[model samples]
Target: MTSLTIIDLSNNRFSGPIPPNIGESIPNFLYSLLSNQITGIIPKSIGYMSHLEILDLSRNSLIGSIPSFISNYSYLYFLTLEKNNLSKTIPKSFG
Candidate 1:
């Protein structure tokens, strides 16, 4: 999985919180879990994926503020998190 560059699991009808160790398993350039039943905070370990360029967790049941470390992804250019229960203003560095 270390060689993987993208992962898209959108609209799979999957449920449950995203595994906290996902970043350790697949540090890819793009990740998407859109339109699922996923609930819980966006895993902080995702910040470890320095090469991440696109992330889409939209239309899920996720809750919690967007992690601050997301702003550290210099390569991240596309992010879609709409329709979730996330709170708080986005990190200033992200904009």
Candidate 2:
């Protein structure tokens, strides 16, 4: 969120689980948080955001399990966590 590069703090009341120093203060930025009230998990340094391409955390209250280091983001296209409260078992390279 430093100087901004597409950060849309979705609904608001942003909670935890997205820290990991957050690219050490915007080392080149990119973000789009969708529908907030964000809870936990999904921050393994966000695979070091290699010029991240569109990650929309759809409707939030995020629980755990979704971070297989985000498949190491091969220039992620569009990842939307449809209706949160994340349960688990999605990571076999996301089936």
Leading candidate by TM-score: 1
| Top of the candidates by lDDT | 1
Which regions of candidate 1 deviate over 4 angstroms? Answer: none
Tens digit of per-residue lDDT, candidate 2, span 9-93: 7778687677766755654344767887777866666667767767888887778778786666667777889888777567676
TM-score of each prediction: 0.95, 0.29
Give the range where candidate 1 is weakest over 10 consecutive residues by summed lDDT.
86-95
How big is the RMSD of model 1?
A: 0.8
lDDT of 1 by residue, 37-79 (tens): 9998898888788999999999999999989988898899999
Per candidate, the number of residue pairs that clash is 0, 0
Candidate 2 residue pairs that clash:
none
Task: Indicate the residue-level lDDT of 39 in model 1.
Answer: 94
Q: Per-residue error at 50 for model 2, in Å? A: 15
RMSD of 2: 10.7
